[model samples]
Target: MESFIILIKLLCAHLCSDFILQTNEINNGKRKSGSKGLLFQFIHSITHAGIAYLFVADWCCWLIPSVIFISHFIIDVIKCKCYKDSLSTFLADQFLHIAIIAILWFSLYGDEIKLSYFESFCSVKVWLTIMAYLLMLRPSSIFLNLFLNKWTPTSPNTQSLPNAGQWIGYIERILILTFVLVNSFEGVGFLLAAKSVFRFGELSKAKEIRTTEYVLIGTFASFTIAILTGIAITRLF
Candidate 1:
C-alpha cells in the first residue's frame, strides 16, 4: 500500500511537471518571454530535472530508461511534425513528449528495478514494447493524416515516405541507436532494423539510392567492433 502511494505521488509529480506546468507556461507566453519571467519559469522547470538528476546512486537505473525514453520521445515528435508538415509545431510537441515520458518513466521505474531478459540478445519484453510503439506510431500517424485530408481540403498532402521523412529522421534514428548501444549490445540488431527505415526515408529524401545503404551494410559488418573496442578499453585502461 505504501509503495502504491509513493508511485502515485511520483507519477503525479511527473504529470504536473511535464504537461500541466508546460501548458500553463505556454498559455501565459512564458516560454517565449525570455527576461520577463525567466526566474519564474526556471523555478517551474526544475520540477523535473534532467536524467542525471533523477538517477541518484543507482547508475543502471538512469542508464537504460533515460536513453530509451528520451530517444523515443524525440523520434515520435520529429515524425509527428514531419507528417503534419510543421517542423516548429512538431518540435514543440517533441519537447512536451520528452517531458512527459521522462516523468512517467522516472515515476514508474525509478528504483533498481529488475527486467527479465532471456538468452540476452534482447529481452523479449523490451523488443515487444518497441515493436508495439513503432506499429502504433506509423499507423496512427497515417490514419490521423488521412482523416484530416479527407475532411479538410486545406490539409497538407499526406506523404507515406515511400522512403522516409528527411535528414531529421536519420539524425533521430542515429541518436536512438547510440542511446541503445550505450545501454546494451542486445539492441544492436534493433538498431540495424531502424537503419533500414532510416535509409528508406533518406532515399525518399535524396530521390535516389545513396551511401546510406552502405552505412547500414557496414553497420552490420562491424557488429562486433564495439565489443572489441570495449575489451581493448578494459585491457588498456
Candidate 2:
C-alpha cells in the first residue's frame, strides 16, 4: 500500500506541476529553440522535482529530487528539440514522466513493492483496463473523427462551438465505456436520452436535414464503437 500511496502522490505532484502550474508563457517558451527555451525548461524541471520531493515528504532523500530534476530536464529537452506538438508526443512525454515515477518508487521501496499495492500493476486486469481507457479516450475519437470527416456538412447551420463535437464525442464514449464496464446498460440509455433532449433537439429543430443527419450518424457511430470496446474489455477480463 505504501508503494501505491507514494506513487499516487508523485503522480498528483506531476499533474499539478505539469498541467495546473504550467502557464501559457512557460509553455510557449518551452517550445522555442534557444537558451530562452532552455531557461524555461530548467524552471519547469525544477518545479516538477520540487513538487515531487515535497509530495514524497522525504526531506532526507535529496537523490529523489536530483533524479527527478535530471530526468525531467532531459525528457523535456528531447521533446522540445526533436518532436512536434501532437497527441502522440504529448502521450510519450507523460508516459516517460510516469515511468520515471514508477521506477523511482521501485528504487526507493525495492522488493517491498511486490508485497504491497504495486503488484496490481502486474495484473492482467489492470493493464487491460488501462488499454480500454486509452482506446476510448483518444484512439477511438481520432478514428471516428477521420471517418466522419467525409460526411461533415459545410453548411453554416452545422457550425457550433469550436471543438464542441469532439469533446462531446469523448465524454459520450467515456461514459458509455464506464456504463458497459459496470454492467449498467440503462445508464447508456439515459445518457443517449439526455443528449437527444439537449443536443439533438436543437439540431432537429433547426430544419437542416443534412446537419441533423450528420450529427445522428456521428452519435450512432460513437455509441457503437464505445459499447463494443467496453463489451470486449469485460469479456477479456
Candidate 3:
C-alpha cells in the first residue's frame, strides 16, 4: 500500500510537471537547439524532480529524484533534437518518461519488487495490453497513413486544421481497441455508425469520387487495424 501510494504520487507529479506546468513558450524553447532551449529543459527537469521529491519526501532516496531529473533532461533533449510534433515522437517521449518512473519506483522500493512481482509485470496479460495500445496508437496510425497515402488527393484540403485527421484516427482506433478488449464488440459498431453519420455531409459534398473513396478507404483501414489488433490481444491473453 505504501509503494502504491508512492507510485500514485510519482504519476501525479509527472502529469503536473509535464502537462500542467509546461507552457507553450517553454515547450517551444525546449524544441529549439540553443542555449534558451537547454535552459527551458533544465528548468522543466528540475521542477519535475522537485515535485517528485516533494511527494516522496525521503532524504535517503535523494538519488531517485536525481536520476529522474538527469534522465528526464537527457530524454527531452534527445527528443527535441531528433523529432518534431509527430505521433512517433510523442509516444516515444511519453514511454521514456513512464519507463524512467517505473525504474525509479522499483529502485526506491527494491524489496517490494521481488521475482514474483517482476514475473507479474512481465506476464502475458501485461504484454498483450501494451501491444494492444501500441498498435492502437503510433503503429496503427503509420500503417493507415501509408495505406491511404497512395490515394491521397492531389490538392489536399487546407481548410481543415493541421493534424486533425491524425488525432481523430488515433482516438477512433483507441476506442475500438478498448471496446474489443472489454468484449464490448457492439460498441465498435455504434462508434462506426456515429462516425459515418457525422461524416455523411462531408462525404456527400466531396467534389471528386476519388476524394470520397480515399476517405472511405482510410476510415475502414483504420477500423480494420484496430479491430484486428484488439482480437489478437484478446486471443493471446
Candidate 4:
C-alpha cells in the first residue's frame, strides 16, 4: 500500500509533473518563440533522466525507488545538449516521453512491494549520492561536444572563433569518444547502432540501440558508485 503510494508520488511529482510539462513546450514549438512558462525552463535540467530511471527500474523488476534520483542525473546529461538553443523544445519532448514510460511501469507493477524503505531512505547522503549517480548518467555526446567547444584549440587556418562546421566536427569526435567509452567490445550491438544514429540523427533501429546502451552505462555507473561510496562511508564512520 505505502509502496504503491510512493510510486504514485514519484510519477506525479517527478516524472509527470516535471517531464510532461517541459516536453509539451518543445513539441508545441514555443521554445524559440520565447513564451514558455518560467516553471518549465527552471527545471529543464531534469527532463530526459526519467528514461534512464525507467530503464533501470524495469531491469530491477519494480523493486527499486532509487531510480527516481538517477532519473535527474540522466536528465542533466540530456539537458546539456539543449543549452538554451532551438533544440531545447525537442529535447524536452524526448525527455517527457521517457518519463511517461516510467510512469507506465509504475502502474504495471501495481500496489505491494518488498524492498526495505528504511535503507532506501538512508541512502540519501548528499555528495555521495549525487556524484555517484551523475557519474553513471554519462552526459550525451552532443552535450559533450558543447562542453568541449568551450575549450577546443583555435584552428591555425582561421584566427577567429571556430565556425559551426568546425564545431560539428568537434561534436563528432566527442560522439566517437562517448561511443568508445560506453559501448566497448561487449557492447558491439550498441556500437554499431550508435555509429549509425549519430551519423544521422532521429528515430531508427540504430538510435534505439544506442540509447539503450547509454542507459545501461548510466545504471551500472550509478549502482557501482553508490555501493562503493556506502561501503567507504561505513568503514570510515
Candidate 5:
C-alpha cells in the first residue's frame, strides 16, 4: 500500500513537470543542436527534480532528487538527438522515464509488493479485450471502406483534408466501443447527438443530397458496429 502511494506521488510529479511545466518552446528548443538545446534540457530536468523532491517531502533523502535530475537530463538529451518527433518516440520516452521511477521505488520498497498481484493480467479475458480493440482499428476500417465504396462520390470533394474521415472513424468507433463496454449507453447517445449537431449545419447547406446521405450512412454504420461489437464482447465476458 505504501509502495503504491509513493509510486503515484512520483508519477504526479512527473506529469506536472513533463506536461504542465514544459511548453512548446521548451520542447522545440531541446531538439536544437548545441548549447541552446542543452540549456532548455537542463532547465526542464531541474524543474522535474525540484518538483519530485517537494512531492516526496523527505528532507533527509537527497538521493532521489539527484538521481532524477541526472537520469531525466540524460534521457531527454538522448531523445532529442536520436528520435524524431512522433507518437512512438513520445510514448517510448515516457515509458523510459516511468520505468526509471518504478525501478527507484522498487529498490526502496521492493519487499512490500508481491508478484502474485499481477497474475490477473494473464487470464483469457485480457486477450479477448485486446482483440476487441484491435478489431476496432483496421478490421472494422476495411469493412466500412469496402461497404461504403459504392456510395463514394464521383467528384470527390478536393477541399477535404487527407484521410481525415478515416482517422475520425477510427477515433469515434473506439470511443463508442469503450462506452458500450462500460455499459454507458447515455455516452453513446451523447456522442451521436454531438456529432449530429456538428453535421446538421453542413448537411443542411449542401446543394446535393448525395453528400448528406453518404455522411448519414457512414455515421450510423460506425455507431451500430461499435455498439454491437461492445455488446458482443460484454456477453462473451
Candidate 6:
C-alpha cells in the first residue's frame, strides 16, 4: 500500500510538472535546438525532480531524485529532438516517463516487487486491452479515411486546419470505447446527441447536400467502429 501511494505521488508529480507547470513559452523553447531550449529543459527536469523528492522526503535518499533529474532531462531532450505533437509521440513520451517511475519505485521497494505481477503484463487480457485501444485510434482513423475518400471534397476548405477531422475522429472513437467498456451505453447516446447538436449549425448553414451527407456518413462509421471495438473488448476480457 505504501509503495502504491508513492507510485501515485510520483505519477501526480510527473503530470503536474509536465502539463501544468510547464508554460507555453517553456514548451516552445524546448523545441528549439539552442541555449533557451536546453535551459527550459533543465528547469523542467529540476521541477519534476523536486516534486518527486518532496513525496519521498522521509526516505532521505538523494540517489533516486538525482537519477530522476538526469533521466528526465535526457528523455525530454531526445523527445524534443525526435518528435512533435501527435498521438504516437504523446503516448511514447508518457510511456517513457512511467517506465522511469516504475524503475525508481522498484529500486526503492525491491522487496515489494513481485515476479508474478510483472508476468501478468504478458497475459492475454492485457494484450486485448492494448489492441482495443490501438484499434480505437490509428487503425479506425485509417479505415474510416479510406472508406470516405470518395466523398472527400476536391476543393479543400481553407477554414479548417489540416488533419483536423482525423484528430476529431480519433478523440470521438476513444470516448465511445470508454463508454462501452464501462457498460454505460447511455453515454454513447449522449455523445452522439451532443455531436449532432454541435454539427447541426454547420449542416444547416452549408448549401451543399454533399457536405452534410459526407459528415453524417463519416460520423456513423466512426461510431460503429468504436462500438464494435468496445463490444469485442468486453467479450474478450
Model 1: weakest 10-residue lDDT segment is 131-140
Model 1 alpha-carbon drift over 4 Å, by segment:
1-12, 23-26, 49-111, 115-237
TM-score of each candidate structure, all chains considered together = 0.25, 0.61, 0.58, 0.24, 0.57, 0.57
Q: 11-46 in candidate 3: lDDT tens per residue?
A: 667766776678778888898777988999999999
* Tens digit per residue, CA lDDT, model 2, 1-237: 455556666766777678667777998999887899999999999999999899889889898889889999999999999987665787788889889988988888756654544446445455455556656655566567666777876664545787777688889999999999999999999999999889856886866677778888889999999999899978864
lDDT of 1 by residue, 82-135 (tens): 444343554455456555555555665656344532343233333333322332
Clashing pairs in 4: 26-89, 49-75, 136-218
Over 4 Å off in model 2, which ranges?
114-189, 205-237
Model 5 weakest lDDT span, ten residues long: 117-126
Please count the clashing residue pairs in each candidate, in the order shown.
Answer: 3, 0, 0, 3, 0, 0
Candidate 1: deviation at residue 135, Å?
18
TM-score of 2: 0.61
Q: In model 6, which regions exceed 4 Å deviation?
A: 56-59, 82-86, 113-188, 204-237
lDDT scores for all predictions? Answer: 0.42, 0.80, 0.79, 0.41, 0.81, 0.79
Q: Across residues 35-82, which tens digit of lDDT does each residue of candidate 6 receive?
A: 988999999899889988886564687876788899999999999998
Total residue pair clashes for candidate 1: 3
lDDT tens digits, residues 24-53, model 4?
444333233333433343345334344434
Best by lDDT: 5
On a 0 to 1 TM-score scale, where does candidate 4 land against the true structure?
0.24
RMSD of 2: 6.1
- Number of the candidate with higher TM-score, 2 or 5: 2
